[model samples]
Target chain A: MKHRGCGKDLAKVSEFIDGGLPAAMCRRIRAHMDDCRPCRDFVASLRRAMALHRAQGRAPSPPPLAKAELRDALRSCTAALKKRKPR
Target chain B: MPESESALISRSREGDPAAFESLVRRYEDRIYRLAKNVCAGAPAEADDVYQETFLTAFKKLRTFRGGSGLGTWLYRIASNLCFMRLRSNKRRPFVAALDLPSGEGLRLPADSIPTPEQAAGKRELAEAVARALKLLPVDYRLVLTLRDVEGLSNEETAKVLKVSVAAVKSRLHRGRLFMRERLAALSEGAA
Candidate 1:
C-alpha cells in the first residue's frame, strides 16, 4: 500500500472503480493497480466505503405525526376562523 | 405519477384531510430520504428538515399554481428545509462519531439504520462512506445521493435538482471522484 499517485492518476482509478470507464481503460487501471501498492490501497478504500454504504442506509423512520393530530389541528384552526367571522 | 399526486394535491387543497394524508403517505418515504441524504448523516437534523418540509408544504399547498409536478414541488420544499438545517451551524454531534441506525433490506425500519452485522461486518465501513459523503458540498451531495443511492435516473434527478442533465453528469462525475477519494481514505484506515 506504500504507493503514490496524483488526482489525475485517480481519474483512471476512479473511472475503473465506478465501472464508468471503457474496457481498454479498465484493463489499464487493473494493470496499474496490480503493480502499484498505493493505487491498490486507494481502490480498497473506495470499496470499503461502498461496503459501509451498503450496510448503513435508511435507519430511522419519521415518527408518525398521527392522522388525528393533523385532523385536530385543522379542526381547531377552522373553529378559530369561525369564531372570528363577522356574521 | 403526475396525475396521481396532482389529484391528491387537488383534493388536499380542497381541505380534504384524507387527501392530504394520502399525499403525505405517498411522499413521506421519498421526502424522508431526500432530507436524510441532503443532511448527509445527521438524522436528528434530517428529522427537523423533514418536519419543516411537510409543514411548509401543507401551508403552501394553496399557492401551487400547477406549474411543476407535485413531487417536484414537494422536493423543492424538502430540499429547502435541508438547506436551512445544514446551514444553521447547530454544532450537533457529527453522525460520523455515533451509531447509524440498524437493519437490512430496502424497505428499512422506521427508526433504525442497518448495522453492518445486520449487513455482516460492513457497518463501520458504511458509516465511513457516509461520513465521506458528508464532506462533500451540498451541490454534489444532493445530486449524488438522489441519483446513485436513491436510484433516480439522470432526467428525474435533474428535474428535482433543477439542473441540466449535462450539469448532473458533471456534478455526479466530480462527486463520485470525491467519494472515491474518501472511500480510499476510509479503507486505508480499515486495513
Candidate 2:
C-alpha cells in the first residue's frame, strides 16, 4: 500500500489529512510519513488550518428572536399575505 | 422554538403568532448562522438577511408546495437574502479555504469562550477567517456558508438553492479551495 498509494504524492497528503483516502491509502500515507518530513509537516499544518476553518464553520447560535419581534414580524407577514389574496 | 417543521408551517400559515414564534425559536440559531455566513459575518447585514429570510418565508407560506424540508427551504431564502445584501453593499468576494482533510466537517469543536485576555486572539482568528470568506463570489459564499458552515448536505443545499447536485458539489469544491488558500495566507501572515 505504501509503495502504491495514490499516484499524486502531494494530493495524497491532502487526502490523507482529510481522511478521504481509502484504508489502503491511509496505511500507505502512514508508512510514507514515517520517513517523509516535508509531507509530514504539510499534513500537520494542513490539519491545523483545517481545524481552524472547520471550527469557524460550525453552525452559529442564532440571536434569540424575542417574543415581541416574532409576533410583530408574523403580524406584518400575515397582513401582507392577506392583502395580496385574491378577492 | 417550533418543535416540528410541519407544526410550525401549519401554524404560521394560519397566522398563529405563537406558532410563528415557536418556529423562530426552533430555527433562529441555524438561520442566523446561515445568514451570518452568507452575509460574511457583518452583523448589520446578517440581521437584515435573517429578518428578511423569515419575513419572506412567512409571507410565502401559503404558496409553499411541501417539496422539501422547511429548514432547507428557509435556507434557500436566507442565502438569497445574503446574495442580495452583498450585491447591494458592494462587498468583495471571500477567498479563504485552508485545505483540510475530508471527514473534517464532521469534527466540529466543542464551544468555549476565551478568558478576557484570550478573547482578542480568538476573535482575531475568527475575523481573519471571516475576512477571507469575504473574497468568495456571492454564489460560492452563500453555498459554502450554507453547506459547510451550516452543516447542510449537498442534496439539501442543491434543493434549497434550486440547483442540481452536481452544481452544488462544483460550487462547494471551488469555494472550499478558495477558502483554503485564504486561510493559509492568513496563517502565514500571522506567523
Candidate 3:
C-alpha cells in the first residue's frame, strides 16, 4: 500500500469531518491527526471556519424588502387567478 | 392533517395562488439568505435575485414534478439566478490554491478555540464571517455556503449546484481552506 502523506490526508480532511469516509479510514485519519500537529491545526481551523459560516447564516433574516416584494408578487398572481375565474 | 408539500404543489400547479403563496412563505427566508450570501452580502443584488427566483419558480411551477423537496427545487432556482446575475455583471471568480504548501510552521493559535462568545461577540463574529465569505470567489463561496452554512448534505448540494458529488467535495475542501485562512485573521483580531 502507498503511504498517505500529510498532503493527501489534509485534502481528505473535509471528507473525514463529513463522515464520508469509511470507519477504518476515519480511524486512520484520527490516528494521523494525533501525531501530526500541522494536520491537527488544519482540521481544527476548518471546523472552526465552518462553524463561523453557519453562525453567519443564522445572524441575518431575509431582508424585509425582499419578503414584501415576494408577497406582493404572490398577491398579484392570486389576483390574476381570481380575475380569470368565473364568478 | 395539513396538506403535504406535494399536495400544495399539486394545487399550486392547478392555478391555486394561495397554495403557491404558502410554498413561497415556507421557503422565502431561506431563499433570500441564499441569494444574499451568493451575491456576497449585497442586499440590493440579493433582493433582486430573491424576487426573480420566486417569479421564475411561479412561472415554471408546472415543470416541478415532485422529484425533489420544495426547498431543494427552490434552491436550484435561486442558485441558477444568483450565478446568472454574477456572470452577467462580469464579477471575477476567486481562484483557490489547491495545494497548500504546509501548515507546519504557521502559528495560528486562534484556529483552536472558536465558540461564538470566545471568538467575538455574536454580531461581530457574524460580520467577520460575512466579510471573510465575501472575499472568496463565487464558486467557492457558493459551495461553502451550501454545505457548511446552509447545512445541505453533499449530495443535496451537488444537486442544487448541478455538479457531480466529487466536484462538490473538491470545491468544498478548497473553499473550507480559504475560509479558514481568512477567518483566522478575524479571530486573532477579535481575541
Candidate 4:
C-alpha cells in the first residue's frame, strides 16, 4: 500500500503500455515496476481494462432508419444551398 | 478511379449535392459512433449531434483549409457538438478537476488479475465497464472513447480535443486508471 515513491512512475505506465515512451523511459518504468508491487498490479489491470474495451469494437453504427433520416435531411439542406448559390 | 476525398470536398464546396452526400456517407458511421459514445445516456442527443456535425461541415466546407484530414475535421466538429449538448442538458459539468492525484484511489487486488478471456465471457462485467465509462467525467470519457474505443491515435485525439499531446496523455492515463479501479471494485463486489 506504500504509494509515496510510486506516483510519478505510475503516471507514465499508460504511455509505457502503449509503447509511446522512449526505450530508456520504458526501461526506467520496468525497473520501477520490478520493485513496486502496487504499481505492477495497477499497470496490469489498466492494460486488461483497455484490452476489454478494444475487444468490444467501435460503438454501434446508427440504425438504418436513422441513416435514412440523416440522408434525407442532408439532401434538403444541400438543395437549399444550391438554390441560394444557383450553381 | 473513385474521386479522392479532396476532390469530393472541392465538388461539395461547388454545390454538388451528390458530392456532398458522398462526403457525409464516408464519415457518417464514425461520426455517429463518436456521438453515441459521447452521449451514451441519450440516443436522441447522439442523433442530433451526428446530424448537426455533418450539416455544419457542409455549411462550412468552403472554410475548410485541408490542414487536417477530412476525418479529423469531422471529428473535431462532432466532438464540439457533443460537448455543447452535454453542457446544455446539465446532466454533467463540462469541467471536472482533471488534475486528479495519480494512483491515490482504489488499487487492483493483486490476486484478481483480469484477463481478456474472463472479461469476454462475463456479460455483467461488460455492463459494468459500460456503466463505469458513462460515470466518468465528460473529458475523461471523451479521451477514453477516442483513444481506446474508437482507436484514434494519440495525435488524432489531441487534435479532436484541441489539446496538447501531453494533456491527452494525462487525461487518458487518469481515465484508464479510473476505469481499472471501477472494474476491480465491481469484480470484487460480484465475487
Candidate 5:
C-alpha cells in the first residue's frame, strides 16, 4: 500500500469512513481503495475496531456507595451556600 | 412538564438545593463515566474528579454564562481536573509511536472481526480493548471515550475538550489506529 498517493489517501481513511469528506473526495478514495489491498484491509480493520468500542457502551458508573456519597456531599455544599445567602 | 435545564440552572444559582441536586442527578453518571475513562488506572482519582466536577460547577455557577451547554461545561471541568491530577503525579502525555512496523503482519485478518455478540462474549477481547485504551494518552483516551464510547459527535467532543473539530478528528483517527494495532496483535496471539 506504499504506492505514490496511498499514504495521503490512507490518512483520510478515518474521515472517509466517518463520511466527513466531500462527496467527490469520497468517490476518489473509494476508487483508490478498489485497487489498494492493504488500504482496504486497514479500513475494514479500523471500522471493526470502532464498532467494538461503540458496542462496549458506557464505562462502569460510580458505585452505589460512591453515588450516595456524592449526593450527600452536594447536599451539604448546597445547604451551606443557602445559609450564606443574604436576606 | 419537566423543568427546562435553564430554569433548573436559574434556581440552582439562587442556592436552591433541590434544583441543584436535580441537575447533579442528571449528569452525575455521565461525569463519573468520563472520569473513569480518563483516569482508568486511578480509581480514587476518578472519584475525586467526579466529586470535584460537580462541586466546582456549583461554586462557579454564577460565571457559567451559558456560553456552552451545561454538559459541555461539566465535561470541561472534569477533563481539566483529570489532566491536573495526572500532571501533579508527574505522568507525562503519551505520544503514539506512529512509526510502528506496518505491512502484512499488522493487518487485521478478516476472520478475526468479531460480531457484536462475539465481541460481547469475549472477555479477553474486551480486556484488550480496555488495556489498549489505558495505554493511550489522556487526550486520546478522553477523545475516544467521548466520541466512541459515549457516542458524542465530533463537534460535541471538540466542545468538551475545548479543541477544534479538526483536532478531534485527528486525535480520534490516530487513537483508533493505535487501538486497532493492539487488537490485531491480540487476535494474532490467540490464533
Candidate 6:
C-alpha cells in the first residue's frame, strides 16, 4: 500500500529533517522525494530558512548590567537561603 | 577556575551562597536568551522571566533529582515563567495565515556559515523572521525557537515545553512552514 503521496511527504519534510519518523516512514519520504521535484525544493528552502534563523538569531550575550543584576539577585537569593532552614 | 556544575550543586545544596552564585554565573546568559526568545523579542518581559526563572530555580534546587541535565531543568523553569507572563499581559495582535506554497522540490546547497555579505542579508532575514514568528501563537513560537533556532533536540524541547515529542514535532513542522512562507515573501520583495 502507498504510505503517503507527495502532499503527505511535503508535510513530513521537517519531520524528516528532525528524524522524527520511524525508519520505514523515512524511507517512504525519501522515495517520494526522489520522484517529486516540488517537495524537494520546498524541503531545501525550508532548510535554508531554518539555517538563516539559527545563524542570524544567535542571541547576543546578556549585557553586563544584566549579569550584574543576576549576580546581585543570586547573592540575595543565597543569603535568603542561608537564613532559612534546609528542607 | 569555576567549579563543575555537580560540585556547585552539591555546595549549593548545603546552603553555600558562593556555590549558588557560581551556578547562576554558569547559566545566566543561556537562561536569559531562552527567556528572550520565549517572550518573542520582548526585552522587558524577557528580563522579568529571566529573574523569575532563577529565583524559582534557586528555591527549588533542593528538589532537583538529576534526572535531566541542569540546562534542561533551568530551561523548563524559564519556559514556564515566560508563558506565565505572556498569559497575564496583553500581547500585540499578530497576523498569521498567508497563502504558502505547498511544495517546491529542489536540492539547495547544504548548510554553510554565512559570509560577510550573506551575513548582511541574514540580518535582514532575521528581522523578517522575528516579525513572522511574532505572528504565530505562543506555543508555536516557543517550539520553533527552542527546536529550530536554539537547536534543542525534540526530546529536550518536549521536556522544556512540557509537551510530548509528537507534539513538539507537530508544532515544529507547522511553525517552520509558517516561517518559510513569510521569509520567502520577504526575500522576493527585497530582490
After superposing candidate 3, which stretches have Cα over 4 Å from the reference?
A1-4, A81-87, B88-121, B189-191
- Clashing residue pairs in all predictions, respectively, total 16, 23, 1, 0, 0, 9
Give the lDDT of residue A13 in candidate 6.
75
Chain B TM-score, one value per candidate, order as shown? 0.76, 0.82, 0.80, 0.79, 0.80, 0.79
Best by TM-score: 5
Report the alpha-carbon TM-score of model 1 versus the true structure.
Answer: 0.65
State the C-alpha lDDT per candidate. 0.62, 0.66, 0.76, 0.76, 0.79, 0.74
lDDT of 1 by residue, B143-173 (tens): 7777666666677778877889878867776
Q: Please write out the lDDT profile of model 1 over residues A1-87, one tens digit for every residue.
A: 223343455644434665766888788777876886656655565454444453455545565653335445556654654577688
Segments of candidate 2 deviating more than 4 angstroms = A1-44, A57-70, A79-87, B1-3, B88-115
Q: All candidates: CA RMSD in angstroms?
A: 7.6, 5.5, 4.7, 5.2, 4.1, 4.5
Residue-level lDDT tens digits of model 5 in A1-87: 245667788678778987889999999989988987777777887777777666543566778877788888888887787788787
- Candidate 4 stretches with Cα past 4 Å from truth are B88-123
lDDT of 6 at B176: 80
> Least accurate stretch of 10 residues (summed lDDT) in model 6 chain A?
A1-10
Q: What is the C-alpha lDDT profile of model 2 across B4-87, one tens digit per residue?
A: 778777877877767877787777778877767666667777877777778887778888878887787788788777767777
What tens-digit string does per-residue lDDT give for candidate 6 at B132-160?
A: 76677777778888887778999889988
State the displacement of the C-alpha of residue B163, model 4, in Å, after optimal TM-score superposition: 1.6
TM-score of each: 0.65, 0.74, 0.83, 0.83, 0.85, 0.82
DockQ of 5: 0.46
Flag the better candidate by TM-score, 1 or 5. 5
Chain B fold agreement for model 5, TM-score: 0.80
| Model 1: DockQ score | 0.24
Write candidate 6's Cα lDDT for A1-87 as tens digits: 123345666667787887878999999888877876666666777887787666655677777777778778878876776678555
Q: Judged by lDDT against the true structure, how good is candidate 1?
A: 0.62
Q: Rank the candidates by DockQ, best first.
A: 5, 3, 6, 4, 2, 1
- Worst-scoring 10-residue span by lDDT in model 1 chain B: B97-106
- Which residue pairs in candidate 5 have backbone atoms (N, alpha carbon, C) closer than 3 angstroms, thus clashing? none
Better of 3 and 5 by TM-score: 5
Question: In angstroms, how far off is A10's CA in candidate 4?
Answer: 0.7
